[model samples]
Target: MGTLFGTDGIRGRVNQYPMTPEMALRIGKTAAVFFRDKTSHKHPKIVIGRDTRLSGGMIESALVSGLCSQGADTYLADVLPTPGVAHLTTHLAADAGIVVSASHNPFYDNGIKFFNSRGFKLSDALENDMELWILDDHKKPPVIEDKAIGKIFPVSDAGMIYSNFLLNALPPDIKTRIGGMKIVLDCSNGATSTIAPNLFSRLGVEVIPLSTSPDGININDACGSQYPETLAKKVLASGSDIGFAFDGDGDRLIAVDETGNILTGDQLIAIFARFYHQHHLMENQTVVTTVMSNMGLGKALSDMQVTHLKTTVGDRYVMEQMVASGAHLGGEDSGHIIFLDAHTTGDGILAALQFLRVLVSENTVASQLANVMTVFPQILMNVTVNAKPAISDIKGLPEAITIIEKQLGDTGRVLIRYSGTQPMCRIMVEASTKTEATHFCGQLTEIIKIQIGT
Candidate 1:
């Protein structure tokens, strides 16, 4: 990660350091110069999309001014999801795409993420180069004159366009595969508020929508994928067969079954893996997942005779591994799923539809599908820190982790890392029993807090 970028992208509280409008202008300028030089286009075309945050308009305006001033034409895909921006970037053959969203963060927070012309996230080297350009003191944005100035175009009906794109990508029997299902959708009152309702309605299912109203500040407030309990309760009250919750930018998905039981992404992945292997739906009998995925998923995949690959915590890392291994499917435990055959990035809505396909094709309920994996007892705890020090340098932290790892041996694992986006440390422990996992995680939590607590 760069000084201004995280594992995902550039994110922070609105109006703060890198997220401020002034910084957004610099980012736009840097992107215009960087992509224009990399691509052969004299007047590079860039697409800009954003979630429904109050600061979105402010950021987009500043970015546009910078890009236009730098001689790059910009297309505005207002209030669209992150993946929608990716799709638009490729669909319009633009030089690159930029999304102004903080994803699952609150409305008070905002972010910027870039996608190349091929609709994939920029690599660390590319981001680092852009960061260097943005911070370079001697370099200045060129002043264009006359007809050389760039223009801004509005990508009207962007939501509908992306919806149609997703629908068209499904199988010919998609309607039959997902027809007549009763479902609940929690859009998190963010980017998917409009797109999800419009997209899911075409599938012939009775959809009960919740949290679709975005008041700017309400995005991800005790709802969405972060709190599947909200969707679970609604599913039970509405008597829906299943429910799905999407984060602010519609890149992650968490689900609720007919029994109001929330299913983890690992569980859903296992179900998909088993079905694809039985039906021979996968082009490569391989699936990519992050290290955060439950160990049970690997066991289940092994039993089903499928190749499983693990990457770092981020979706970009998962995507890189998928590409390298020629795997068509990849995702994280937090619900960011990628179907590389259909889309270049992780898409929550598309994953939901694909999950629906499995449900109907097998003629079963989500509660039963969840049985594909038996989750190992796991606990993830985050501790706010005054400063982020290397975990190895924190006194007693490494020794404690070592002790736990030795005790765990083959039955479990311990992973401790700092949050790439926040000023905190996360401790994750998985063990054969819930009690053991909890005990070990508690020990690490206290150690982290004592070492760097505020």
Candidate 2:
């Protein structure tokens, strides 16, 4: 067997090798053993949560069985967001938390990710140990005796607890300020379908919810953050002040302004960074973003006298840098924004609330607020590859990238890297114009294809 974990977690098509019930069970057992051995608690507890996926029930049952068999009690937060699970883990003081959802992927795919006691994703070292144990026949989990066996129970108030936490994160006067503001929400028929709609309604917003009904197979079916065009149309048609689209697991968010223009995560971050700086809320006068962020965002941050720190792709790396630098804001261009003072992981609903707070407090509209930073034209291309070779080993790829970088000079930038969660290489270019960005991006894609494409 190969490594069971990826950048996010163990993910694959449902019923496939890594996503199968057997593998989920083994993962649960191995994770229980690992956590139990690491903690001083004699009987550790694990919390499991999942999105509205057809395979979620099957995977959740297997995980519960394996965890119980290993004498680890389990609490089930059924159909909750990824960030909700992370929050519940720390709230309930569980030893660990597991989320069963492949994020923004199609419904046919599933995944499992672990969060430590502190409500953060498990470190690579811990995941590696669990992976080794999963494949170790000699270390197979031994079923506990009858008296020591663990029990599983439902967390009836999980949603309420998480919702209250999110509400409290906002200013006390938020409801009064946002009252009667027409807002559209696209929940992607996944975890936030209920939570987001109810939360917004309670906050006195005129909420027009889309894709709030999840029938297992409809999650992320051309309606989530991955496809904001539908939401954009809805926002314009409904005459809403703003719109927010969340991924299947509610860890990412993409916004649609009133004019039906979709705002990239970079634009959102830039807006918030300036707001935070003006309000003296930004710690260390810095914000963190992934390498995939637009160069325009960096330029904007510099103009605002705020430092910009770039981390490797992935919210985990962004969070790591934030914690090290004491930055209160960090996120990816893919819409995974992390508000360290608010929540541990990327909570789409929480981020949306923060954005709304900024708008209400500033007494401004989405389009005007979004104009705080000028977004340069960016084009990204992904090329399938047969192998994962080091960038240095890719003949002519470096020279090609260097030439493009020098040609673009200070007005543009180029980034060529392999996707951490997929079998593809991503070539991203940002230039002064759409034509320049697209033309150069196409050239780089061809170079990558010839050097390493499948």
Candidate 3:
């Protein structure tokens, strides 16, 4: 169980060291005991959900066995989005919720993350304690009598309940104006395959679904948020007003305009930030995003006098900054938008709904709305590394950055960091032109590859 947790939670290729069934069982036992002791609920209870990965059932069974052994009555939300699991945990009054997924990753990769009773990620302190407990060799789950053993129950209406709750968050005016909109959805053949279509139909929109059939291994196979070209083409061919591509777990969204151009999350954030500021919807006139966001977003938000607070790469870090600053709107370039005024965590459908509302209310097309910010030409490159190391400690990397910084000046920026969930160093360079960005990125990529690339 050595440092099984990452920026989000425990994730790896299924059947591997920390991602194996044994580790999952230990995690289940530890979480069951930890959250059980901390909750004010009448009894120890937990809700478990998963995406459409083939290994989901294997890990889910292991988790259930461990939870039941420790007498945590487990509710199984068979195939639900990560955010839906969070909602069910809070609504069902469970002590905690665990989602089995590797958002946006391939089907072979799976992960387990938890939400507290309030539908929020477990605090770092809680996670640390749980990790320590899981790692302790002397700690073992106590055997319970048959009568005291926890039982498993199914949440048959989890999708419906979550969808209705999302709809309820919308105002009457937007809801009324949103009808008659024709939209396309590429579900990524994962958790949102059914739920997103169902939710959109409830809003009286004509739904055109793509990649909705999940065959376990097909999830995120060049068909999701990470690959929106297919969705963009469909929107053009079908003549739909807009298209949305959701990641495997449905916590991220990448949208395509009517012109078949995929809109970056930075563009979407710029739109929302300006709209929130104009409508006085911003809690502190702030919009928080990751450092990976396009520089243009910062310039646009700054021009409009909206505070553009930047955090580290992870959505967890973004959420922390947003909560600390009381910002109502925050997102990432990866499309993990968190609307504090709506749901607790990032919900792709919820963000899509809000974006659609803006489209309707402003009486503008998505392409025009997206033009709220100019997207700076950016290039992102990833290098596989043999081991993780502090970026500051990477020899020669700092000097190279300083030199590149001098060259770019005020027109652009560069960001280099390790992926929290993968063994890769991501290099992002933004410049006034793609040629300049590529040159800068190539320089950094070679240095990192020479230092640590596998």
How many steric clashes between backbone atoms does each model show? 0, 0, 0
Tens-digit lDDT string for candidate 1 (1-454): 8798899989898888878999999889888988999788889999999998889999999999999988999999899999999999999999999999989888899999999999999998998988888889788777778688789999898888899888987787866668677899999999999889877887888889989999888999988999889899989999999999999999998899999998888887888788878888787899999888999999999988889999888999999999999998889989999989899999999899889888888888999999989999999999999998788999998899999999999999999888888777889999999999999999999988887998
Per-prediction TM-score: 0.98, 0.96, 0.97
- Tell me how far candidate 2 lies from the true structure as C-alpha RMSD in angstroms: 1.7
The candidate, 1 or 3, that scores higher on TM-score is 1
Stretches of model 3 off by over 4 angstroms after superposition:
none
List candidate 2 segments past 4 Å from native.
450-454
- How far residue 32's Cα lies from its native spot in candidate 2, in Å, is 0.7
Candidate 2 weakest ten by summed lDDT: 1-10
- Candidate 3 all-Cα RMSD: 1.5
Count of clashes in candidate 3: 0
Best candidate per TM-score, number? 1
Model 2 Cα lDDT, one tens digit per residue, 423-443: 789989999899999999999
Q: List model 3 lDDT by residue over 348-403, tens digit each.
A: 88889989978987899999998788889999999999977888888899999999
